[model samples]
Target chain A: MFDQLVAKLPVGICVVDEQYRLQYLNAFFLDRMRPDQRHNYLQQPLISIFPEQAKFLTRRIKSVFVLQHPSFSYWEQRAHIFPFKSSRPITGEETQMYQNMEIVPISGPSSEQKLACIILQDVTAQASYLMAQQELASALKQEHTAQRKLIKKLDSAQSQLIQAEKMASTGQLAAGIAHEINNPIGFVTANLATLKDYSEQLLNLCDALADKLQVTSPSLAQFSAQTMDTYHYELLKEDISPLVDESCEGLNRVRDIVENLKQFALEESTGWQLFNLHETTQQLVKLVGAQYKAPVYKVSCNPPNLQIFCEPASIKQALTNILINAAQSIKCKGFVKIDIRATAQRVSIKVIDSGVGISAENIKKIFDPFFTTKPEGMGQGLGLSVAYTAIEKHKGKIIANSNPGRGTVVEILVPVVHPEQRHECAEPLGGS
Target chain B: MSTESVLTADQRDALQELMNISMGQAANSLAHLIETKIGISIPKIASVTPEQLFSMISEQADAYYTRQSFLGDIQGEVMSVVSQQGLCEVGALLEYDAPLSQTDIQEIILELSNILAGACLAGLSAQLALGTNLNMPTLFSPRKANFEEFQWSNSLVMEVQFDIEISSFSMRVVFCLDDASLDRLTQTLDELLG
Candidate 1:
């Protein structure tokens, strides 16, 4: 019964003598040994049985016997102590059995003699489970990153939707107001024309009155007639015409702002055209230079007559976001240098700012969406990432270099798309 | 009371004598095993802010850094800065494979830091008759240390560099003691001086 019980245990058990020789092994261990090994393993050295770990294991085993202390060998730091296959050769899922081993010294009565007993545990299932868990955790991490990206994109789309909704309602309000103004404008313009003709007749009558007043040569009567006649002519030709012109200018300014607002709200642009790069750069500089402080902006182009076919509106928004970032990076009076170079296949634009720069550690992660170092409400951290996406849409690359207290430089290389190659970005297919 | 003021020259002299003996013992232990001549510089003791501490480490190239924090009745970290120059040669002398990866280099650094720092602290503490617990060593990036980000400002530092002459490898081991431990260390040194 005891033998059967010993045999029933799953793993092979072995005990070695002080001299690194395998002196005893359980029935299970004996049975699992190869047919060739079983014939010769009796009273054989442990090294002979396991050839791979011979040198290291022998040295370790010597330490246990010498120190007369219990020693442990963990599969945690180094698993697979012995490369033995699983017992279930035909049906077992396991290819290799993970092992943990511990060695304890058994002292004999002689001062010179000692013995060490070694125990091995099969940890295949635990190792595989741990590996699977590690893989699962890593996969979850990757999925989490992907999910965060999707959520950021969703959030941007949501903000755009909200802004577009507001603009749409505002446009409706403007159209309504325009409708009201148009009716008044039509009649007022007609009335002004009629008024002008009336004023012309009145002025003619006044001129005749002035001329007649001058010829009569009666001082008091001529003075009263001339003062009244001059007043009528002055109202028509001198003051009223200029007032109308000034009002026209004021209305035109409002109309221009509303038109620009409409253009900015548009999600799509129908036509792509070859645009002057220098003119676009100047327009962008003017747009941001009016708003930000603490930084002076300078622009230089290598080739003046360079042009690129692009959606000018989207590209302009991208530039505006970046310039704003550069301006904000500076704490004190700092210089922002913009260098543009046109190559055969692409245009390279570099925006550099002398400001509080990024640290080396944070540089790698800056391109990740929503990873911002700016203080609360100063930035959403989405600007550079959005710029990245827009440039990527044009099959371009952007890089950032910075050192603390020195400055930051962002370089962008955009492939100059030809007119034939300009295509609108396709919307994501699924609503999700 | 002066808030992390360093020891005076006489105090430094007494502390240096204690360190010299302990460092010698540690070097003897390493030399016995590696069979190579190792040299230790006299301890240059100072009270430093954490920023100066980081700059002290970041200036070395082919050099990797590791830090081990010890806690007992007192607590602080021991930073071991090891140079990469002739490391493969030294690694060969120590029986590691050539052309190490960063992680392999890191593992080697951890092992070396554990051994040397463990010996150094044990020797120093044994001489002063104080108890100190040495923790596991981990690789550190010196340049990434933003000292302003740390809560603690001043530290009592005992810094020394050891060079193995058989090979061109050099390593600097620094001991940073907290305020309470500084008091303990100075008292212990005073007792040894007496």
Candidate 2:
């Protein structure tokens, strides 16, 4: 009955004695091994049957005999020992079966030899689940890179806007100064005209006197005419014309500088409007970049009138910051491109520049307060710090993608807020 | 001094008595089911290594090995040696019919080890008034170990043999403790004996 039961077993049953020879191979074992080896391998050593795993099995089998302890190995460490084809050849996911083995020392009067037993279990499903999790982690790492660049651009625009604000205020002051200077120059010029008329009258009277002398007293006329000419005409005319021209020229230079400053610092209405994304992008690029002469700025928002509802002032500030950063990143003329995409739910503004990309170590600190890559006095390093502040206020997200020496791209997303949702003067940023 | 010296003679006797009572209960659980007379050799316990075990059971050349471990107030493993002869009859008595496949035989051994080892440990702990936990049963081969390479000294071992009076069935369960645990076991046994 025991012999019959061994033949009827579901799994392969093979027992090897201490000498490592096959003491018994049940029907299950015969059904799996090489057909010729199945018959011949009987009573033969297991090593001669499978030569590839010979060294590994030999060490393990010997340990079992030496320690007199049960030893086990699973598919987790070594998946395939005997490369038996999957029991389900047609529909199985695995080509080779995963196996587990056990070794034991059997003691009895008739058989004092030790035996080794092997069991196999399939585990394809669990392995695949673990692989899927790794893929997700890698994808997250990629998305995180993209988010950083947009934040950088926002920071730059903000800093540029601050500069623009200073320039604009200075421009306003220049205009006021021009008005105040004009007040005093008005009377000065009019009085100078009247004094020239009086001087002409006095010259006429002197001329008349000189004629009278010429007729009455020829000697007196000669003396008087010479004296008057020495004191008057040629000297006065020489001094006046050049002084007037120079005063006019100096005032004009001051006016021109003030105009440029005002343009740099232009402020718009605080409310939302359907502003043309393309036009605003151009204006922002021009405005911020006008002060920073470093990087080349390019604008491409095709269908130029791509309109979106946003506070134009803030949008300009955001873009200007990005463009300025692009400008600073380039040692020579490098391109900075502004792209605006309008959709039903939001607007995406991308500022891509061929600037020095942020380094990995510094990228983490980019959003940190007062972190700057600029030389002292050039910047307070509040650029990206402020950018992060603005993006958060707008319920938007900005990201950066940078490759050192290659370029950096900042992507900004502005949610389409309904009329009621927009807040004015809600603080530019909560101080990043 | 020696790890064994901690166990006084009186404490050792008490521990042996506790083992005899637990083994008696374990044998009864099997004997009542098989409807056969069951006999247990005076209970002997030992501290042994895999190599030491190989020689101890040299008489049962073709026998199967099954071990179950328990832990709680005290922790130890119950290793059973089943003689290859007439095991099928005992397997049948355990509700596993004859025509036994290798796996079926293994399954019966593990199940038998679980019930007997679990119950015996429970009884032993109760006799000592200590709580314990029993782990799962696992099969092993003792002859695979190299005795020469083994570094353990001749251990303080208390050994026992159990025999099934009917159906040619016989087995043994050896409870081995580490040296530190042996000392603790002696102290607990002394307290109980007192």
Candidate 3:
């Protein structure tokens, strides 16, 4: 009964000797073999029967014989060690059988003869199911990574859109305000000049009348002098001219501010042309220095006459904005150095300032519109953002590095726009 | 109360001697098979809680682990910790090619554990006149195991180490018998002492 059960077991059982020659094959193994080989396979070398897996099979069988212990081969490492077809060949997805082989040392009844028993278990279904699940898991992981990258891209693009929209509307608002202020400034400036001349002439006429009255009638002159003394006429003559001069100066300041607002709105006629970077830096230093006198400004350029093809008006405005920030960053005394270096394809403008630098957190949002650290009513916070927009038009970028209280370095990297590509940028550089 | 006290002084001494002989045989079997000089250290016997067992085995960061179970006159499990250093040299001596694959490395660890553990068990059982059969070994991760939830609070453990002279690699095997098997082992040792 035990012999019958061994021959009829579901698992494949093959007995190979110490020499790895076949000794016996159970019915399970014989059923998978060819009809001719089934009867003749006895006494044949196991390697001759399965030459492809000969090296591996012999090594494992040899280990069992030497160590007098069991040796195992899992389906995960060496699947389908045997040349056997799947039992469920018609319905199974896999063509070959996945086998887990175990070779254990067994001694014959004589005790002198040693043999190894090879037990092979079919694990095709389990192997296939695990592989399919692993594939699905890796595919899901790849899809998740792709989605995360897309979400990050969308977030940055959306923020840029918001910034562009804000800049467009602000540009229109500035243009409108500049127009209204321009008219009043124009008339007020002209009237201040005429008032200055009129006040000077009236003071001279009063002086001449007082001298004539003193010579014409002595007693009448005496009464007139008494009247002049009561009114403090001598003090009035000395202060009148200076008052008119100061009023004219204040009016001129109003006109200069209105001019700047108009430039901020962007002039529609500005076009791409060759502009000298060296000269622009000099002009910018002079202009800002007049207003902020505390910070000493310095300008340097490589290849002294480096002329880059760009929109002169907008480029000037961008530099003016950056220089103003550099000047304002200083409270009492500091130096602002402007360095312009040009490569074959781009020009780098570095503005280094020895002033209170930006903090780490606020540096990121410096290009964002209305992001300011200034006290209320002191700054509009549109300077750096407008500069960023202008540089973006020229396919450029700005990098700011600051050490909180130490200093700040702002680098504007702008691509050199050649005149040949001017037609590609047909749109007027009116509103950045 | 304690695993050491579970056996009388004579039985403990007998058991310790038996363990030394078996471990020496195990090291000799492996050295003969691999054609290398393998050294064995005196086996240490202890009774430990789950936490102690975890700390003892999980202390090595760079080691591969395997666990096998045997059933027969006594039932218990054997855990092996193999150092990863100089494993490739050992693999070459075992007729494996250099630049071993992931599967090759795993197979080496499992096969090496099986040989040492099987030899030790077979030798020890033979001395006690008991029959034991060892099952296949599988890869194990001590970090992932929840030692606190183990059913046994304390168990007698026989620990031994095998050092390969050809490389820096060393293997430590720990044997832990079940509660019922411990009683059987002690009784068998007593009879042998008599």
Candidate 4:
């Protein structure tokens, strides 16, 4: 009964003697062998029947016999040790069988008759499943990394949108205040000019009367001189004209500043236009230099008087914000250099400052809206963020490089003509 | 001190001789399996506190560790420490291919521990006419704090080192017997001396 059970087992089992001669083969092993060699295989060496893996097989069998312990071989290391086809070759995906073999030492009735038993199990399906799982895990990991990068980009874009909204509201408020101030400035200038004319005409009439009185009546002349001395008319006459002129000059200055404010806030003509970039940069330097007198401002433009097609106000505003930041960074004395280099394709504006530089930790957050190192209420921390948005609208890039206690250099690059504008320009020419 | 005095000098000497013979057999089995000459140091026997045992085993760095327990006439655990250096060469000797994977290295460590520990236990049991069964081996990493918290104060430990001639591969096998097993082992040594 035991012999019958061993012959019918599903796993392939075979026993070999100390010299590796085949002693026994169960039905499972015999069914896969050639019928002609089956009868003679009992007394032959195990390697003679399976010569493909002869080296590995011999080593394993010898090890089991000598060590008196089992030795294992998996499909991962050596796929197939025997010349066998898959059990379900007709339906299975694998063309050849994957196997795991175990060799254990067995003792016969006599001490000299030591033998080793070989057990082979098919594990094709399990190995295939594990490999598929590993491939899927790696694919998921790659997708997770890509999604993390996309999320970071979206986070930055959201903050930029918020900063743009804040600037829009501020611009609207300035526009309203500029319109109200223009009404009062118009009448104040006209009334001051009329009052100056009236006073000058009355003083001329008094001067003629005094001359007539001196010539016609000597007694009346004495009385007139006494009255002039009593009223201090000479001092009044000297100070009156100069005071009116100074008041008018002050009013004109106020009007010029309000006009600049209106132009800065105006959104009309936001479209692209050909601009003299050199003139714009020089004006910016003059404007900021007047306010911050300590910093020595210098402007250098290569290929002098280069022109670019961009929104004039926005470009001026972006440069203005950067210049202000540079000026404020100086504690005592420093210089702010605006270097404008223009190529046929793009314009590069580098604002270099010799002032207190930004710290490493704060540099990364500088572009983020509302991220400020300044004391509360001193700054809204929207200067760089606004500049960033303006540059982005023109499809440009802005970068800042700084060394603490040394200085900071901000580089801005804007294409001379945007890609969409280039396409539009080519369309009309093509049609013609 | 109490645990130290339990074994007489004659009994200690007799046990050491018996351990030497068993360790030789263990090394011989591995040498024959790998077709290479193997050398072993003289076996050392001592009664040690838990702290001493932990220090003795955990001091070696860059080594793979494994433990297997045995049952029957005596109960004890066997711990094996194999150096990580030159393990690829040793794996080749055991019929494993070059550039061993992590799994392949793990399997090699377990099998090597089982063979040496099993043979040593078998040789010792055969000499004393006692039956012993060894459980499967598993990887072990000991922490000093955990070992110091062990309930057993002292144990009798037997240690031996095996060195392969062709390779820099070396391993140390430490056998620790329980309190009752230690008494049984001493009695068995005395009987052998008689």
Candidate 5:
């Protein structure tokens, strides 16, 4: 009855003598081995029966016999000590059995004789489930990283959109102001010219009346001359024309400024059109120079009148931003030069200035929105960033080179025709 | 308190001999259950502060620790330190399945401590003609802060080591007697000697 119970045990049990020769095999152990090998395994060395695990088995068994204690081995460290198939070989996830083996020293019926017992237990399902969980965790980590990067891109794009909207509203405001100023300037200009003509007629009438009075009566003429002397008539006649001329010139200047503001705003047509690069550079210099009077503004155009098809207002805005930056960089009495060069298919505008140059560190972040060196409320630091966006729209490149306390140079290159339409044009100019 | 002051030379000798015999019985019980040869070292007796006791147990790196308490004629706690190496072999001998989970390892530590500590306590109690009840075992980590905060100023410690011949496996068991238990133990030793 005891033998039958031991044979039916779920665990694999085998007994080996001190020399490691197999003495007994329970039914669980016999079932795992081939029928022929099972019958012949008795009295055979344990190594010969499972030659592949001979070294490991021998070591464990020897230790058990010498120390007279139990030795343990787990599947985690060494999965299968013996090459055996899983109990559910047909439906199991693992092809081979994952075994935990233990060798224990046992005394025979007589305490003098020593024997080693080997026990095996299978555990494959637990290991497979753990591995699957680890794989899922790693995949989730990768997905989380990708999502973070996409969110960062979306954040930058949203800020750029907001900046563009602000620029559009500012342009509309400028256009409205220019239109209102033009109305008053028109009438003021006309009334000043009419007043100048009416004053000349009044002076001519006074001169004729004095001449007639001198001829008609010497006393009356003498009285009239005395009255004219008391009124300082000669000085008044000399200053009137010069005053009218200066007033007219000043009004003309104001009109010119209003005209430039209207052109800069370009609210009438934002569409693409042919634009003269040299002309745009000159206008940018004038507009910026008015505010930053410390800089001596100069313009140079090689093969003048280089024209490119682009959005005129936007190009002007880009150049204006760069020119103003150059002028403002000067503390006092420095030169700002605008050089325009054109190839057969492209145009390059370079704004060079002798001013307090940017530091090496600040130059790198100058084009990033809201990165400013100026004191609070003095500058918004959006100038270069706005220019960068406008130039990008034209499929152009802009670069800045500067040295601290020396000077700065900003260069912009734009295709003569928009890049998308350049293929239609037979010749393309290479510009740097 | 010093070891000599706690117990006279005769009392110390008598307790040491009794501990040796009880430890041997504990090892035999484990050997009988696993059908393996288990060797035990003679027990060493000492009077130690909590810090000393902590260092003695925690000095063994990569070892599993457990604590059990007993009550009745003697009141004391038993701490067992088992090496992590060759644990798989021990697990198999106990009929545990392969690829032992964390819980399985914990269970093995607890069961091993209970068997060895229980047997030693039972043997000592039987020989002394004292009645004692062993409590369940629990896993313990010997952290310095916790040891420093322990309420006892000093304890009488009896320590022993068990080595298994079949595998490179060894465990140390430490017995600590509370103040009242120490008095009881010395009184019982004197009676035995007399």
Candidate 6:
């Protein structure tokens, strides 16, 4: 009964001698072997029977004999040390069996002769299940990374869309306001001119009347002189001309501001064209200087007539907005300098202002739409944002640096050739 | 119950002496197999709370850990702390290639733990005239395990250290026995003492 129990055990059992000759095979092992080998496999070398794993099996069996202790081999290190098919080949994920083997030394009657028993256990289901779980976890990690990247991209695109919508609507509103203000400015300017001429004529007529009355009638002259004294006519005669001239100048300024508004709102007129950077900078400084006379405006260009192909209207608008900010930043005597330089493929413009510089935190949001630190009704906060949008259209870059108490410097870089014309220019240069 | 009262001073001394002989035999077996000299320290026997056990074993920063259990006459576990330093030299002694892969390193660690832990348990069981079988050893991480909710509050712990003379390699083997095993062990020590 004991022998039958050992023979019918579920595990694979094989006994080998010192020379690695198979001495016995249990029923579990014999049933898995070929019909001829099952009947006549006794006393055969273990290596000859299973030559594929002979080297590894022999080494392990030798260790057991030498140490006289049990030696173990796990499936994690060496999965299949035997050439056995899976018990359930059809339903299992793996066709080859995964086995964990153990070798133990046994004595045969006398301690002088040593024998080793090999026990193999199938563990295919456990290993395959664990591997599948690991693969799924790694796949999940990759998907998480890809999703985070997509969310970041979506956030930037949404912000850009919001900025574009605000710019379009603001541009339209500015155009409408400019058009409405244009009519009032025109009539006010015409009326101021006529009033100045009329006041001048009336003053001259009074001077002529005073001289004639003095000569024609002494008594009448005395009356006239008294009336003139009572009215302070000499002071009036001197201040009237200056008052009218100041009014006319003030009206002209209002008209110029309106004209600037119209130019800034010319959204449809923006088109790629060859523009002179030097001339534009000079014009911008002169215009902004007239409004904020406290700051001294200086302009310079390396090549006096350096030209670039770009949207002339928007480029001018962007520079105008930047110059206005520089000029306004100064409360007292300071200098605002514009330096333009042209390289082979690009132009660089630097606007340096000796004014109360922006704080570090404020500089970051200077280009954000509707962000401003100015007092109410002093600024609309759209100036820098508009400039940012215009330059971005041309694929140019703008950067600002400032020291709180010192000053601020704004730098801009624009490509000399438009992207559409870049190909055309490259071909000629290559040929030459 | 107090852990010191579990065994008398005479019993503790006898058990310590028994562990010394068994641990020395384990070191000798390893030396014989590797053809190198190995040194062993005297075994220390104590009763410790789970918290003390966690602190004592988890303090080594650069070490590999393995745990194996044994059953039959007494039920207990063997926890080994193998220093990472000079592991490459130990791998060389195990007939592994110079540049060891992950599988090769794991196999070496498992194999070493098996040979040493198995020999020590076998020697001790033989001296006590008890039958015991050691289960397979597996890699363990003390940091990952939660010790606060451990089932056992206190255990009888036996500790020993082995150092390979040719390299800077050292490993600490700790055996923890349950309450029933502790009782069985002290009773057997009493019989030997009588």
Index of the highest-DockQ prediction? 3
Per-residue CA lDDT of model 5 for A175-246, tens digit only, reads 789899999989988999999999999889989989999999989889989999999999989999999999
- Model 2 RMSD in Å is 18.7
Clashing pairs in 1: B62-B84
Tens digits of per-residue lDDT, candidate 2, A1-432, equal 998897777655667777778777777667777778766675798878767677557755664454343445445445666766666678866677666655554553476555765443444445444446677888888888877887886766676567556745764675576566655656655665666666667657766787799899988887886786787755654665666556656655444444444443444456666666786566566556657777777777745688766666666656666667777787777788888776778778888888878998888787665678888888776666566666776778888888998998889998876554444424333333
Candidate 3: count the clashes.
Answer: 0
Candidate 6, residue B67: how far the Cα is off, in Å: 2.0
Q: What are the models' TM-scores?
A: 0.50, 0.40, 0.75, 0.70, 0.59, 0.72
Docking class of 2: incorrect
User: How would you encode candidate 6's per-residue C-alpha lDDT over A1-432 as one tens digit per residue?
Assistant: 977998988888899999999988898788778788888788899989888877568767876776677888898988888888887878877888888888888887687889999998888888788789989999999999999989986765566556556665776797798899889888988887898888889889888998999899999889989999899999998998899888888888777766665655554644566777786677566657767999988999998887888777678878988999999889999999999998887889999999999999999999876677899888767778778877887778999999987899999897678646854433333532
The candidate 1 chain A region of ten consecutive residues with least summed lDDT is: A423-432
Regions of candidate 4 where Cα sits further than 4 Å from its true position: A30-40, A48-55, A74-79, A83-86, A93-96, A162-258, A265-293, A296-344, A350-411, A416-432, B1-21, B31-61, B65-81, B89-104, B125-194
Supply every candidate's count of residue pairs whose N, Cα or C atoms clash at under 3 angstroms. 1, 47, 0, 0, 10, 0
Interface RMSD of each: 6.3, 14.4, 1.3, 3.3, 9.4, 1.7
Report candidate 2's fraction of native contacts: 0.00
Question: Could you give candidate 1's per-residue lDDT for residues A134-201 as a string of tens digits?
Answer: 99999999999999999988987675455445545665675566556656666765666677677667
* Per-residue lDDT over B94-174 for candidate 6, one digit per residue giving the tens place of the 0 to 100 score: 677779888877887888888888888988998899988888889989989988888998898888889999999998898
TM-score of chain A of 3: 0.67
How well does candidate 1 match the true structure in TM-score terms? 0.50
lDDT for each residue of candidate 4 in B5-87, tens digit (9 for 90 to 100): 66788887887888888889889988888889999999888888888988888888899998889999899999999899879
RMSD to true structure for each model, in Å: 13.2, 18.7, 6.6, 6.5, 10.3, 7.3
Say which prediction, candidate 2 or candidate 3, comes out ahead on DockQ. 3
lDDT of 5: 0.82
Q: Best lDDT goes to which candidate?
A: 3
Candidate 3 lDDT over A305-403, as tens digits, reads 799988876677678888999898899999999999999988999999999999999999998767789899876567787788778888889999999
At residue B183, give the lDDT of candidate 2.
62
